[model samples]
Target: MAVAPIIVHPPLGTGGRRVTAHGRILGLAYSDGDVIEFLRRAGLPDAEELLDDPSWVTWRGGRAHHYEAA
Candidate 1:
């Protein structure tokens, strides 16, 4: 049996929560430096602007694994 990976949207603000398939809520960090560090490792340049705000949070819902900006 394979455990599905939890889907995470990019951090929108200082903090957020992501619900996993197993129903666990993981805290999403959004400190400017922290977000920058994560974005640096994430390798997505398109999201640079989104990481600047300190009060934005993202999330995805439904049975499907598609994540959209929130």
Candidate 2:
């Protein structure tokens, strides 16, 4: 199965998280639920599935960010 890629940048100065899909910025998220909500708003087919998977990691720089179960 093909998985949709979710990219998360470092936290903003204002404490919001930037989320991206396909190189396009979705929006800023204040929490994990906000991330998922943004993805859903963006119409990503696998948004829920992606977050539901415990193995999924939002990558930053050249490494995976620490996983925090939603």
Candidate 3:
């Protein structure tokens, strides 16, 4: 298995804080590593692939969102 390249996106909010797909606040965004860790904690398979692909992630109301890719 290979590690997918990280795709950096702007933080969900003005303060650059981290939040969940549902808009639940997590904390300040630090690095891609933190996102990966969050995904891992959420038990999402192919977390790296999902994070690397912009199509896999979305944003609404300035909140980061994610869903299963078709």
Candidate 4:
């Protein structure tokens, strides 16, 4: 058995406060794609696969803050 790789996200810029996703602190990257990529690269294959899902809402600044559960 081998350990999986982790891609830690930078820090979220939510009015100076950190955002919590799945109970973990989120980091703000330069773009939303980065955040999405971070989720994928962070050993979350399902996160990467959801990029094309209609529920995925990526803002203009690469921020997916308005994500709604579908």
- Local distance difference test values of all predictions, in order: 0.39, 0.63, 0.48, 0.42
Best by TM-score: 2
- Clashes per candidate, residues 3 or more apart or on different chains: 3, 0, 0, 6
Candidate 2 off by > 4 Å: 1-4, 52-57, 61-70
Q: Name the better of 1 and 3 by lDDT.
A: 3
Off by over 4 Å in 4: 1-19, 52-70
TM-score per candidate: 0.28, 0.60, 0.47, 0.34
| Local accuracy of candidate 2 as per-residue lDDT tens digits, 3-41 | 346777776555666788777888876676777788888
**Residue 61 C-alpha lDDT in model 2:** 37
Give the per-residue lDDT of model 3 (tens digit) for 19-48.
364444443445555666676676666666
Error of 2 at 61 (Å): 6.4
Worst 10 residues of 2 by lDDT: 61-70
Summarize candidate 4's per-residue lDDT along 3-60 as a digit string, tens digits: 2222232233543223234445455444445556667665555775654443432233
Tell me, by lDDT, which candidate is best: 2
Show model 3 residue runs off by greater than 4 Å: 1-16, 59-70
> Candidate 1, after superposition: displacement of residue 38 in Å?
0.4
Deviation from truth (RMSD, Å), model 1: 10.4
To one decimal, what is the Cα RMSD in angstroms of model 4 from the true structure?
A: 10.0
Per-residue accuracy of model 1 over 1-70 as CA lDDT, tens digit each: 4433333444344334243323444435333344334544555354446533323323344222232334
Report the Cα lDDT for residue 37, model 3. 69
